[model samples]
Target: MIEATGLTKRYGKTLAVDNLTFQVEAGRVTGFLGPNGAGKSTTMRMILGLDNPTAGQVLIKGKRYRELKDPLRTVGALLDAKWVHPNRSARAHLRWMAAANRIPAHRVDEVLDTVGLTSVAGKRAGAFSLGMSQRLGIAGALLGDPEVLLFDEPVNGLDPEGILWIRKFMHRLADEGRTVFVSSHLLSEMALTASDLVVIGKGRLISQSSTKEFVSRATENAVKVRSPQLEQLRTLLVQAGADVTDSDDGVTVSGMDSEKIGELAAANRIALHELSPQAGSLEQAFMQITGDSVEYHTGLEAEAQHVLEPTR
Candidate 1:
């Protein structure tokens, strides 16, 4: 398990990470989420001992990363897929890493096959495409068979198939009781892949909870009702302290659940064609929670005007 206690970092006058306290339990995929400039990368670096924290500390299995006898065998990370020698072949890269950590040479071939890079084992790192580079990076992370893994945007440039592969691979790691902590901007994929989430914004913790609970609490649940007597239903729903909004075929009621709305309609003898509850999606919940933490805002009109203006 990974634990952060009052973890904080600063760069001169700017604070990069605030007092972050959270735990990434074993046997689950935990997503680390944040908007741009939210200091996610900074926190990950601190966790790996790549950067020194201004205050506080992060521990891997009850010890700091620097204190580990064999860091690779304890915690595996793929922070930057491109941080490899361009002249090195995929096999050569893994071999070097294995040699550094005293990992067996045969284990190199095993990881190469595990990441499906055995076919391109002889290819230079520079010649590999983005997807292939990511695969190679993952292969190195698994070389030590670490119980903890950290991946930063592992699916950034992947195709649909590659994305699916990574998702299942993370799940498999968690199933083996490893601690899997992934940081990504892909909310939809995170929703499907992560069992829990750690959301940060502006160098501070925003939320930490199970994926289902976080989304449900952040979004407003509403009930959609469709009926031939739409007008009557709307009137009744509004009078019952529910906010009603009209749609093409129905009305959406908030401030109440589907069960209450259904009972009200039934008692009023209103014919109902469809009544369904609408739960907010992960994206919607993310936007609602991080709306204020967004560092950049784009004005559509300003952008359009700027684009339309001719320049030298």
Candidate 2:
């Protein structure tokens, strides 16, 4: 379990992370999501005590990470997969990490097999693929058998198979009552992997809720109505106070459901073509939230502001 309070980080005049506060509970995987430059990495580094926060503190199991007696046994983190030496074999790399933390060397072999890198453990990391490197990093993290695990973009460069493996692995770990916190750019993947989500934007907390609640709240309820008598259907829907947009694709109706729309169309005696409900996806929800904070906006006023501003 982990808790962060008022976590803030600054780089010169720029505030990279701003007053972020959140909790990672035990026995579930909590996803950290944000656009690029949204301070996710800074927050993770602060949690791991790799980077001191400007004005806040992070605790692991009710104590500061740095103060933990056996940090490796308490927290296992894979900040970056490229951390390993390119020339060293995977086994050697994990062995060195284990040595530094006073972990048993046998953990190296056990984790190697756990990550499915046993056969290729002797191969040079330089010759390994991106997925292989990610697996090796995960193997190293699991070496300590820590209760809390943190993975930053664990599937960044992984192939489809590797990505699926990582998703299931995280769920499995959480199901076993371990705490798992993972950050990802891929909203779709997170939708499948995480049960709970913590979303941030512009270095601020946007949401923290169960995955089902998040998706449901983020999605707009929309209904699609199609009819040969398009004009009659549109008129009926408009009269009923539904936002109707007619297009070649079909008539899109908002603020009403398919069954209601069907009743309206039937009452109007409009010959039906098709009617269905549309659900917004996780990617759609992410885009909607981040779209509000997009650094660049295209419009006449924005262009004028750009033109009037002095160039650096």
Candidate 3:
């Protein structure tokens, strides 16, 4: 298991990470999520001892990364797929890493095959495409078969097939009782892949929960109802203390669940054509939770106003 308590980092005047406290349990894939410049990369770096924390601590299996006899054998990471020698072949790159960690030479071939880079094993790292480079990075991470893995934006350059492969590969690692923590901006993919989530924003922990619980808690449940007497139903629903919104096909009712809405319609002698509960998507929940925490805002009006304003 991986744990961070009061973990913090600073760069001169900028505070990159706040007092983050969370645990990544074994045998599960935990997604680390945040908006741009949310300090996710910094936190991951601190976890791997790539950057010293300004305060607090992070540990893998109750030991600091620096204290490990063989750090790669205890914890594996792919923070940047391009952080390898450009002139080296994929196999050569893994070989170099294995040598540094004292990993067996046979493990290089095994990991290359595991990542499906056997065909391109001899290809130079510089010539490899983004997807191929990501595969090679993953191959390096797997060289030690470590019990803890950290992947930062592993799906950034992947196509559909590559994304699917990485998803299943993460699951397989977790199934083998490893702690898998992945950081990515792909919310939809994370929804399908991660069993739990660690959400941070502006360098502070916003939420830490299972995927299902987080979504359900962040989203407001609503019911979609359609009837011939749409106007009447709408009035009745509004009068019933439910907030309703008109849609193209139906009126979405909130403040109550589907069963309550159905009972109300029946009592009012209304004929219901369609009645369905709309569960919010992960993207929706993420937007709702991180709406204020977003650092970047884009607006044509804001830009135009800035340009038109008088200059001092």
* Candidate 1: residue 196 Cα off by (Å): 0.8
Q: Which candidate comes out best when scored by TM-score?
A: 1
Question: Cα miss at 171, model 3 (Å)?
Answer: 1.8
Report clashes for each candidate as comma-separated counts.
0, 0, 0
TM-score of each: 0.93, 0.87, 0.91
Q: Which digits, one per residue and each the tens of the lDDT, describe model 3 over residues 1-312?
A: 999999999999999999999999999999999989999999999999999999999999999999998889989999888988999999999998999999999999999999999999998899988888899989888899899999999998899999999999999999999999999999999999999999999999999999999888987778889999889989988888998988889899888898888898899999999999898778877876876677876796346434433234
Local accuracy of candidate 2 as per-residue lDDT tens digits, 61-93 = 999889988798889999988898899999999
- Return the clash pairs for model 3, or none: none
C-alpha RMSD by candidate, in order = 5.6, 5.3, 5.1
Arrange candidates by lDDT, highest first: which order? 1, 3, 2
lDDT of 2 at 176: 91
Please report, as a residue range, the 10-residue window in candidate 1 with the lowest summed lDDT: 303-312
**How does model 3 score by TM-score?**
0.91
